[model samples]
Target: MALAGKAAVVIWNDVTPEARSDFLAWHGREHVPERVSIAGFRRGRRGRAVSGGPEFFTLYEVENEAFLGGAYLRRLNDPTPWTRRVMPAFRQASRALCRVEFSLGAGVGGFVATAVLPELADADGAFRSALQRTAEALFAAQSALTGLHLLRCDANASREKTAEHGLRRETPELPAGVLLAEAGDAAPLADVVAGFSEKMASETGRRFEAGRIAIYRLELCLAAGEVLPPWDGSPTFAGEGD
Candidate 1:
């Protein structure tokens, strides 16, 4: 499927190993479903870093740009009790609401490497065309890369707004754009991505130097209506009076 929507919300962060189980439980069982159930949300996926530290990334596909400032913002503002409990434990979180520029691929893979590129000053057209050409070349190679996608950040939505919720880490200055490449093997894919980045920089006269690029391995994936393992623990809700 050609990228399903016009926008996507990408989040990167890490939590203590001690809190990993509770984190995954909240995300897999509660968080993802709640977000996916919202009006404009399409689907969500999560991955863990294979080599990079602070190991977790989540992607939420949304219908359009408005969804970010509208429904999604409301959801973020009003957290569930479980969300309040688990979210404060997140460390080094970075979030972006991006406009999907290009997507070329067939299926999900075992690993994904992302290149976060800075937005050019006054050359949007040139940058976009160059990226498209590079994507075509990569697509034609039919190499190990299982998928490729490009996303342009929506500045207003990209702000580190989570500070209000009490996760003390400073929000990162959002990247101008993001390039995602996925593969079944992490090692070879990393090499290919490094080469591809060089090619992109050389061809576009641009550098992907501002933000870090890392590879993440698929950990757990959940979708709407998918049954989660039964939780027989005590009930938790955001507004429930303890």
Candidate 2:
């Protein structure tokens, strides 16, 4: 399916093991719903790593790049009490504010593969054309690949500090670019994603580090219209199921 919007914020972070449950509660009960409630936001998806990379990955689709600096940034600067409670436990957090460069899909798959692709020093129209062609070929070869998205990171936009960032323990990271592929099962993407990674690297004449690529099972999903449980401003850790 086409994305809900033109741009998205992709994040990768590891929460302290001791705070995992609280993190889950904060994310599902308070975070996702709150973010989607913003005017330009569309949908949110949270995933838990089943194979590699960080413990959690979250994607928030927004109407366009402008919203990142507008309502979104405003919300970031004024965090809720629950947000403040959970933010301090975040670690190794990397975030990217991105424009959807290329995407192909019919539906949201049960599983997704995440990887950070290096930036192209002098990318041009021809480079984008090549990227689409490569994506099409890769899509055609793997039936399990139900959805795929390529995001071009806006480093400047992503690097801005906010109240939330100030609460984190470690420094924030900016990814060069990001690739997301969704499939019904994890097996098909294991080799195909690495292959695409290599081909993409070949296009840029750069080394593709596939080590960060990971397969995650979809854990939480929220949409703009979904009804969220009321947040009473308490710091209770409620799991998604709760």
Candidate 3:
């Protein structure tokens, strides 16, 4: 499957080892399902690094970029108790609310690779279009890949301040243009990702850093259809800023 819609929220972060257990519980049990239940969000996936980059990566598919500022913003501004507690555990966070530029796949896979491409030169749509075409051709030749996608950030939506932002230890960095490749397993990704970088660089007349590619293994997945109702059982639940 390509993507659920035209836009997605791509997140990268590290959770301190001291808070790892709590972070996992809060994220899988409370956070992702809550977001997917919102009107425009379609699916949420959580991945833990198998190789490089941040310790955790999150992806949320949305109907369009407009949804980022709509209900999703409200959710971020009003943090749930678990969200409040877990926010402080995050380090090196970068969330990019993006427009899905190109997507191809059979469906999502168990393993994924990501590259944080430098921001593209927006003045030349044709140049970016050529890159997209090259990506599509690369996708066609890969036997192990289950998904490939290009996402360009919507800066304004991503940088919007929220109550949740205040709970974090540091400010979140905005997403740059990103390229993600998904596969069913880890064995085939290194060579494929390297090929993508080399080929993309050749097509774009620039050096695409293959070394930046990071690998992750899917940890948790939730879709709107599977959303559980929010729980209200914790009496000691501390809301944001507590």
Candidate 4:
């Protein structure tokens, strides 16, 4: 792996039960490829919110800042004919992940799902159970999934940042969450997205909550002087700010 600049787009859409399966397949097969082929794109993948919501995530890896700048913007907004054709399947509201460089590392990927704990806050054990069940359904539907870990915030780990884009922070009281999935490149991501829909439907009794599910794409940036760990098949977790 190598340090590369990453950009992720989060889209929330209105999807129908009948079109769910077709939607995922189209993204995994047709849509993702079109985006990955854009100049400056080294890798790409798509993911779905497994909670019956219109939320979805797409990730793109770029060579450098220059590639993500003026020229890249033109190409993205003025997508090729292929993209023009595929864009209709998705209803999207896009959010940009601030530019970050990640170290080539062993972990699958990092994620942050917010606005969910509030919904589950009053429910306690049942909430945790349902949350896990939702995650399981997502993975089961998408067999390519490797691992999912639930992180409970520790009091000392809390911190906050606010900017023009959005408010971002880590707080123990705030209920933070993350998911890790197996991925090599963008090609296989569509399957995961499709599978996610099926699983969410099964787990949630077919009712989707659009406002409660928030999905984020992450590029794991190693702090200054940190080195990628050897891939030894051991479970690992990075402590706060490590």
List, residue by residue over 1-242, the lDDT tens digit for candidate 1: 44557998888888867888898888887888888877778778888887764588988878888777666777777887777777777888877788888888777768888777765333488877887888889766857777888888877767736533455353566778777787788876666667667767888776644257788898765554555655656676888885
TM-score quality measure for candidate 4: 0.39
TM-scores of all predicted structures: 0.85, 0.90, 0.87, 0.39
Query: lDDT for each of the candidates?
Result: 0.74, 0.83, 0.81, 0.41
Model 1: per-residue Cα lDDT at residue 217: 90
lDDT of 4 at 166: 26
TM-score of 1: 0.85
What tens digits encode model 2's per-residue C-alpha lDDT throughout 1-242? 86778899998889988988888888998899999999889999998899986888899988888888878899989999988988889988888889988889988888889887755434577678778887999998888788888888898888788998798764455667778899889888778778888787787665545547878899988989896767655755669557
TM-score for candidate 2, residues paired by index = 0.90
Which pairs of residues have clashing backbones in candidate 3?
1-106, 1-107
> Highest TM-score: which candidate?
2
Q: For every model in order, what is the number of clashing pairs?
A: 1, 2, 2, 2
Per-residue C-alpha lDDT of model 3 across residues 21-113, encoded as one tens digit per residue: 889878887989888988889999999999987888999999887788878888888999889988988998877789988788899899988
**lDDT, candidate 4, 1-242, per-residue tens:** 33234433223354445656665555554545555555565666455554334456554555544554454455545554444443444443333322331122333544433232222122246554665676666655644444333223222212222221121111123322222244344334444443433454455554322224444444322222233433333456779557
